[model samples]
Target: MDKEEYKEERFTERCDDKVESIGGDYDLEEEDDSPVEEVRVTISNTDDPSMPCNTFRMWFLGLIFTAIVSFVNQFFYLRQTQISIGYSVVALVSLPMGHFMARVLPTEDFNLLGWKFSLNPGPFSIKEHILIGTMTAVNTSTAYAVDIVILQKLFYHSEKPFIAGLLLVFTTQVTGFALAGALRKFLIRPAHMIWPSTLVTASLFRSLHAGNNAPGDEGRMTRMKYFLLVTLGSFIYYWFPGFIFPTLGVISWICWIDPENVVLSQLTGSNGLGIGTIALDWSAASYYVQPLVTPWFAQVNILIGFILVAWIMVPWAYYTNLWNSKDYPILSPDLFREGGEAYNLTMILTKNVLDEKKYEAYGSVRMDSFFALTYGVGFAGLTATVVHVILYNGKEMLARWRSARLENEDIHSRLMRVYPEVPDWWYISLFVTSITLSLITCIVWDYMPWWAVLLAMVIAIFFVLPVGIVQAVTNQQPGLNIVTEYVIGYMLPGHAIANVTFKTYGYIVNVQALTFTADLKLGHYMKIPPRIMFMAQIISTLISGVINLSTATWLVETRPKVCTKDGYPFTCRNTNTFYSASVIWGAIGPARVFGNVQGAIYSPVQWGFLVGALLPIPFWLLARHFPNVTWLKYVHWPVLLAATSNMPPALPYFYTNGLFIGFVFAFLLRRYRYNWWARYNYLTSAALDTGVAICGLMIFFCIQSWDGEMPAWWGNPSDKNYDHCPLGAANYYGVIS
Candidate 1:
């Protein structure tokens, strides 16, 4: 039997765990492969008068936590909503949602009991929630952290003002959700990717559901305990930095202390490590990344991320000749007419006014060259993905069929443990639902065109799907930013300059990357209905959008000083990050005239891709036996080499991140698990981050107000009288580090 059939058998019989009799309300099947044991989950007891009470408490707690997190994020950034609330809440709340969803849609009905609270069956079970939530949350967080922090803040410094920032986040996320909605059925279901995250989350939910159903054991030991821990842990994590100390976060800057850096440091130009306010704790969390432990393996893990990034950046510098200090001097001189690192360093000078000089960056090319690459990769990935699917996973698909044919026995758990394996039809319906919703949303929001919505769906179907799959397979995303940029370039047709239409669509690409990666991760976890998971993300994101809008509205009207003069909404962590990247990248994209001026020089990806394709050609000649040194590895090696060349400083950030991952891995993977590390470490880390970030943001807001103390103190004279001032200013939120 293939994997699907094997899984079905395991879930049915010859497996041992739940000790309750499911009676006729359940179904079972046995596979010859192993000893059979029944795994039962208790459906909520609808008959009990207290059923509503249980649900009320669970959902009530969930909403409270969400609100609290939103409040904290708002206070720090001066805008609430779109708050992460950490993955734990995402994980915890998902279970309830999953169970509730199953009941509303399930094919069968049954009743079951838990410790103190009995679970009722609508359709599926809590297990689905756990697996789905876990998978999606990880990738979402990963994509959020890596892309937002690095690309946004480090790369593009968005400059639309506070309200604009809110709009940007809202628009982009909605676009992604809409796109995911379009592709959910085609890619999510039937593929049975068994997204790792969804599976595990589902497992956790099953444990809870089953434990509740057991005669002697009730929800008391299970639901109450876990729920309390999650809440207590979440609260403590939020306040830890405030009450106790701070946690630090980091990014790498080889040029900061590099002597070469000082060489480029022109009194009139933006120079030096370009590092100052970012590293130290925001309030208590070190703005600078710091880790408690540096494990042997973490070094390797960080090296991997660094390698990919460096390969794209460093070699291009060498090949393009940007590394030579005496050559171009892009960093020095009164670079920006309006100053500000965003205006000064970026290829395009979008400052107080469109600095004409910045737009003239690329030599013969416009900045967005990646569009062609994306188009090419999309085509290639699409063809290969389909073929691979048919070849590699075809057996399992057939087995699911055979199991269905042989007996109507294989189905959703009696107590709704796993959600009924979602059928493809559901996914298709979700796509249609989203398309219609997006159109409705567009009309209501007046943010996008009707045709634009249709085109986005097409793009999602053809391009984003392929990219999402690749990201799932190898933790790397072939982001379509360049592709979309090019599309915008052509459709919006910026006659010599980037236009508004381009800018509008550009936001969607950013959202697409964020959404795709999150979904991939989510699917990896719970085995939740990709269709449903897709819908949930949309629902949650929409909720986030509303929150962002309301907060931004509040900030704009009441705290207009902070919103405009102070960069209230604009400076919120990830908001600024993406804006920065989009502008910088837009400059470099092939579509922009000067985008490629230094392309061969500074673009690691450009040279890396070329180098990757060509590197192996020569390696084959160098050693006949070195077949392993082929293109993929060859291309990857340079990226790796470039990544680690600037390693040591960035080490702290990656190591700390890994400390959590390691803690999780160690606790989870080690047969005899130390439950405490598994449970509390994540909570502790979350608390540490919340406290630190909150403090820093609040301080930043205060300092920016320059209410009296540091108004003039933040002023600087050398860098074009730009008044860049202390790091917390509208120009230097980077200094919040």
Candidate 2:
């Protein structure tokens, strides 16, 4: 397809009057509507080019928040119930701080090397606010590479040099920046790729700056006021779930009815099927799925998948004793032996490589029915993503690829053309540098082979766009970890470090790239300079990588029994899961677990790839044939299959509770209370997240950190199993650890 033809087919001619007026406020009555209704309402079509973005105030505040968020997130990463302090929290906190700095800092200009600038740049502009958000967004979660470091140090008892780990983290974190930069034309500049999650953040920023005094907004609570009030209420209410009456987090009344009945506990416990579970805590409900910001259709798809896998498939598999499921916990992240004992890595390894003789004696590594099945689902999710995207978005993607310089741009893209674009060489240079460093880190440190590093990058490059398309449309990403692990496990069977390193590079690079792309889309919508956005992302990624590794290293070294169950709240749930993956896919290898080897039992699970690839075909055909059946179009196979991806670490209650809330807000409230939903939906989500995060941090520092314990009672049980299901973690065979 030629550029003109592609442009004609994909987009309408550029309307200058709609977006060319600089320094004009967004007048909704006068402007043309965006192709996306969500974007039309949530984001402004107009731009103010005079607004300053790359300011001294932005850098100062952005760096400070980056450090704080990186440390806090990594600190909580080791806890039993992990809570992330998201970018929305940063946006809320930074607003007043930015204004305070603007008020206090001297406006007097400073000259350096013939260039002039000021510490305080007039009033705090929305551009500066967004730049800060861009910076902190990169640090929202702990760097993915840190998981490898933690896996090795805490589980493997072999820590790589600080420099090696640092380079590994930095290269993996920033490599995606290059890919995102290259794909911006397809993912960001286009109008239809709304990146639904960003709209929430954008709406929050606009509300903070635009104020509540807009002419028709009388009697309605301003967004900022509403956010603050909800935040305070959430903060106060979290104390019960966070500490005092912890049972409120997961109220499994069915388990309470008969804790002594193993079958009932397995069916209804917080750690089991979580039947009849009610999570009053926002943190518990929103841990895996962010219900408020996610669209109703996507949430429904996820809920369907969760029900199939968790509620139906898993229970049936356990009761039927599939792959010795009755011998292990009904749902657990822990790897197990033939007799339901924890798989000891030390017994199976000799100098960090699996020993054939020791492995023969130690028996095969196993997992519960839920964990094994989730891997199969993951396989399906990956293939389903590729097929789903090709079916749904192939034409547009092909057109975008053919049209190098798209002429028919959207209002946001057109407004963005005024600012200088980040040069392609900038991304190319960074990409090359990061890849070289990654290869060196892998080969020199013996984390993985040089060819494995290249292969990992290849996998990431291949899957990133398809997976990114899924996340862009629906706020869920199907991960590459399962694919990466399966491939490298067969390739390098006995190397644990190599397997994890390969997975990190393959999975995290794609994830980080999508994250960077999402931020760029946010910048495009808010009309920030592209060059400035690039700078913020790179700097924040680098800083956060360092902080994440440092904090993780510090905790592992200083906190005694940090990863052990006896460590109380410090029990490393995620790190343990990472270690389990390393064992199944690296040290023990998939051949010994899923192949025709001596102990192999679940080879049938490998058929998931075919299952996943074919599942989308029928859905696509049905949607095409029955064009009038609007609901047929919403059957997203990728989202549905990937729904149970967080199963072992995230229990069934999380989905059940999150879906209930999603129905209330995304469906019922969105349809019944359009005005309220439009105004406060995203804000409510942000406020809830912020409140939970703040309350969690305070609980740790003020009470938990100092060994301040709550008095033992019914709600705050001494056993600490808040659901009161004592036998939930036991196997049907009566193996209780």
Candidate 3:
């Protein structure tokens, strides 16, 4: 048989096996109310109402993981190569811990206030496992507002009181919970709103709880055993790339061929164009794009977009001296003067506000060609997201919004209705309380005017649904950072603190809302009670916000030169990028950089907004006309444009390496080795992440904490660039320092 026929037969066999394993009346091939084929195969349509979810064992284990995850994420946020501990890692590690507690803890029931629960929750069901995953998932990344706090204390030389910082972090993180709760009917209840990543997590949870194999799988190794083996192997393998042979992270062989040739090195180096770069390190490769989890189609779109911009357009722009690119490094995130020296913020600002006299003498603030273009790309991404969602999902969304309840409720939604839904008033009260506190914190602390804070909320409310829809369907999230920064930069110039504060409120609120919505869908798939999920999410957000701020403050106080290049591995790459953005759009103001006031050298970049809005139209129209053209429907413009959004902090090699790996696993294996791909794909992704995170923490605490260094060798270079392409940082014009 041919490949397509073989694949179809295998898929049918798998679906039959899944139905038999689930042991339900619902037939996979005949159920009209089922979701897509992908969801049907991965998630069970059955539910057990007797499973214990809100037990003492759940809260104790959930809270412990939440604290550890928040602390570890915040610790790595300052490093040169930051690695996030995603919820999948937590899901893997917490399983054995929960089962062990079930065996050890007393089975006797306890009374708290009016409710009764047991300490040991009868062998730890999938409900409790999901709740623990939800709690850690909420705090997997550090709170967004912590970046503003770091920017204020380290870069701006001004610090806010601890209480003010706490309030800011708490308010920004949970205000979106209210928005998420309000919009559940349109975003969550519909079967078409699949939320692909949640399906992977749900699959992992079910597999962990499934004690035996199906009839066709008796000889194969179980998923849990495979996971443990892979995780152990990953932990042992990370030492070479993580410490002993650090150059394995970025094997730029083309640059090694002729490191002194500035143009060739700049094109092939890890820090530059990354034409032929390869990374053996799983942490570095999977840092930006989670290869195994992201769909192959989405990876293809991102690769196409990255190549067009990073390879073709950027080189053309730099060589042609667009915006005088020859004066600066071909690829950099730093703001510079006309002569290629770093812009001195202290000389131009007075008390964190721009000094008009000093600014006039300092000339126009400049960014490298790539940095300026990425902002333009970000502008395109935002508009493209709105347009793409409208073209693709508008009618369904409108119909869902108009109707009180969906006519065709999927089995998952029907199962979820057995539990009491979270009340509308619960979310409304939270929104009112958080927004009120946010207003007070901003006004009382002089962060921004009350009107700007309100406007920021307005922006968040406007964008959440469309952005959430895009993320729900595609695994990519188009950021609101550029739009927020541009809006506030124009409205209130020369105030750096006000810029970042507005950004945190406007950009992060939408992100937090989507996060809550995704978690709710996970609960929906796993059959956890709505009220229980709501309470777990809120509690976790509050706890995580407090822990995140405390950890960031402690690091800033104890570490000397904590954010500067002199800090070595702790150079705070992301925070520095944040500071550069503040200078470009806030303190320096866009008028002097992109506006006509200073001749508008980079003003042409603003065309991206129009370009993004229109780019989706042609492909959408073609897809509508040629419905048989299957590939046309997969042309997602939003994911394409947002591909390079993480360029500055994420090097070019991350995308190059990630896309290649994604192709190998998501495409090649899924097509050729269907059974192995289904059984171990997500497990492999989770194992690699967990192993790398544990090894990184150990290396820091045991070896690097006391100032011990990897003895200098060819592999462990003295310069620490790793790519060994020194000339990549030099400008073509040979500008003097």
Candidate 4:
């Protein structure tokens, strides 16, 4: 059924309620605040004529699956971070969660699995399992690759061990979860907010529940066709890379293809896209979906981001010859200096010594430094974003609040539900925690100045809103806080060179728009107290911060060869890792004459104002001149769930590990969502994820914590040898002179 019909049908009580007590028959009551309709769902055992079977098998399976998820989530292997653990584990756990949810939920009847299906028109609703399973898969799979890993790691310049570096991500997702929980009713029931991702998941459940008339089946043969599609799709993906279409998407003609190029080389080596844990992260939000049909929005996003970053940003740097090679300046590759530092023009890395020592430098950033900024932004701008969101969206929120309060009266009366409200103390504690932790990090390491520490916080506060939300749109995330960092850099006592420029007003605006895409997703599925989610994220931030540092130190210490190496092998060039880069850029403003306070504010991102001002002129002109083409409709944001890469890939790579997690589960569960197996799917997903997360954390402590790669020198691996220098801090600045 289409969305409206589905809601109409769903709201009307029928065969069974997933959580019947709370979700009373929508058709039965149409009161603005119907007491019965508000009853919350809970699990309860159905009357079983026979004894429950396989207790030992269930326990054993759960334990094994949980262990696998834990290991995978906690460790990094190959190029993949273990975030896939969530979907994979959840796929397995769905079995138990489904059984439990089914048992507890008040259903008119019960349906068992496997052989039991034929006994009595299927006692355990296969439909329920399918729905829940697909949702579980969607929640874990799409969110990570589309939102977190791709955006942060690839587009926004997030840390490799993002766990160690930034707070915004952990904070945002957790907050979204909590807020979504509280805000779900309004978003889902009547307001018409298209929770697109969740809808796909819900469809799966409906299908599974259909006894013979399951959703998505044109007929038994049509359903048979789906099984065939899966077989063919799976076989082609598995074999094509090793045997046939190796670089599936690439131009096989080879004439236009730059076979020698690193990116091209990597793609050439790519195992044709299948159920890969190996992510091709274009941004934290970038995903490797082989959509049979690409939407204009996604196509536009990729095209726009590519044009701006490649055509504008790269060229601007090249023209300036930052590498100092007037004859032949290199713009993109990594170069090592005897002294560990950002690619400075002065540093020579053997550029045809016979002819010239010309070299071009690349910019580097520290994760700690950036986090300091993000933390500051989270502190200051978070308030602004939240306040603005609430205030601007207040009327809607109030109505929702009132509606849920009334509707939930029946559910509360029945069950001892645990809808805990996150308190004021939690937020206050977070503020204090951020302050204390940052100070501890800085003072203990002595890597930056008190002013810089203050500056970092100041940095994060200024950029958080613009950076976060805009990223939600444009399918692009500019690192170095494209707008705020530039403004701050230009305005600072030094750093006004405009060394990095946010390019093209059209695309920059697009990029900036994608920031809140994750929040939008959370706004759909969850019903937890917003305040609680917000607080939980802050708490997660604290945990992530501590872990970030430990991991970063290991990466630096283990390899001891950073910028000097060819590619920034891991998340080495991350903002937090190059905290010192902040100072480097900060000192540039006073160096430039025109970069005074006013001059600083006049930099690029301020173009937001220009665009805001002039955008309407063209818009009105378009409507008048070419009424057929609505230019505004073409604008797209990367932050949408369709685009947002929140958790699918990243979660598996950290904080969780379990044996049962696997890529196929995510794909299979999603494909079968409309089957009878849908209902218990989501519950199973949650269980699997939880199990894997627990195991992943344990694995982190066992292997990752103790056996991590340690840095050899105090500087980037190539230039400075720590063997000669003290184990403490060493300045690569000595080599520059």
Each model's TM-score? 0.54, 0.91, 0.91, 0.44
Window of ten residues with lowest summed lDDT in model 1:
42-51
Query: In model 3, what are the clashing residue pairs, if there are any?
Result: none
How do the residues 1-737 of candidate 4 rate in per-residue lDDT, one tens digit apiece?
79767543332222211223435433323233212221112111111112221122222333343334323332222122223444323433455454564455443433355221111222343332332232222223211111223223332333344332343233322332322333333332332233243334334333433455555544444332333344344334423221122222222222224423322222122211011122222111112322211233454443453334333443353335322211121221222232334434223213201112232232221111111222222223223333433333446545544553454433222221222334546545544554555454434433233454455444444444344432222223434333444445544433211111111111222222222223333322333223323433333333433333344344444633332322222332222222222333333331221233322221232233333333334434455567677765444322121121211122211111111122223334446653433434343433323433344344446544475533333222233221112211111111221
lDDT (Cα, tens digit) per residue for candidate 2, span 464-542: 8767766776566777788899899999999998999999899899999999999999998998877778888899889
lDDT of each: 0.36, 0.84, 0.83, 0.31
lDDT measured at residue 26 in model 2 versus the true structure, 0 to 100: 42
Candidate 3 residues 1-737, lDDT tens each?
99766544333321111111233333434464464787889888787665667777788889999898998899888877777887778887888898899899998756678555567747777888899999989898799899989988888878989999999999999998999997788778877778888987887788778767576788899777888888888888988888999889888899888988888877888877888988999987887878998889889999999998898889999999998898888888888888788888988899999998888887778888999999888888888888887888778656644542555778887776666688899999999999899999999989999999999999999989877776776655778888898899999989988998999999999999999999998888887778889988999989999999998898889777888756766778788889899998899777766787756588888889999999999999999999999999988888889889888877888898988999999999999998899888988998888788788888888988777789989888887777787766678753323
| Candidate 4 lDDT score at position 574 | 29
Could you give the candidate ranking by TM-score, starting with the highest? 3, 2, 1, 4
Query: What is the C-alpha local distance difference test score of candidate 2?
Result: 0.84
Question: Which candidate do you rate higher for TM-score, 1 or 2?
Answer: 2
Query: Residue 71: error of model 4 in Å?
Result: 8.2
Model 3 regions more than 4 Å off:
1-42, 111-115, 190-192, 403-414, 469-477, 733-737
lDDT of 4 at 221: 48
Clashes of each: 116, 0, 0, 154
Off by over 4 Å in 2: 1-45, 190-196, 403-414, 465-478
Ranking, lDDT, top scorer first: 2, 3, 1, 4
Candidate 3 has an lDDT of: 0.83
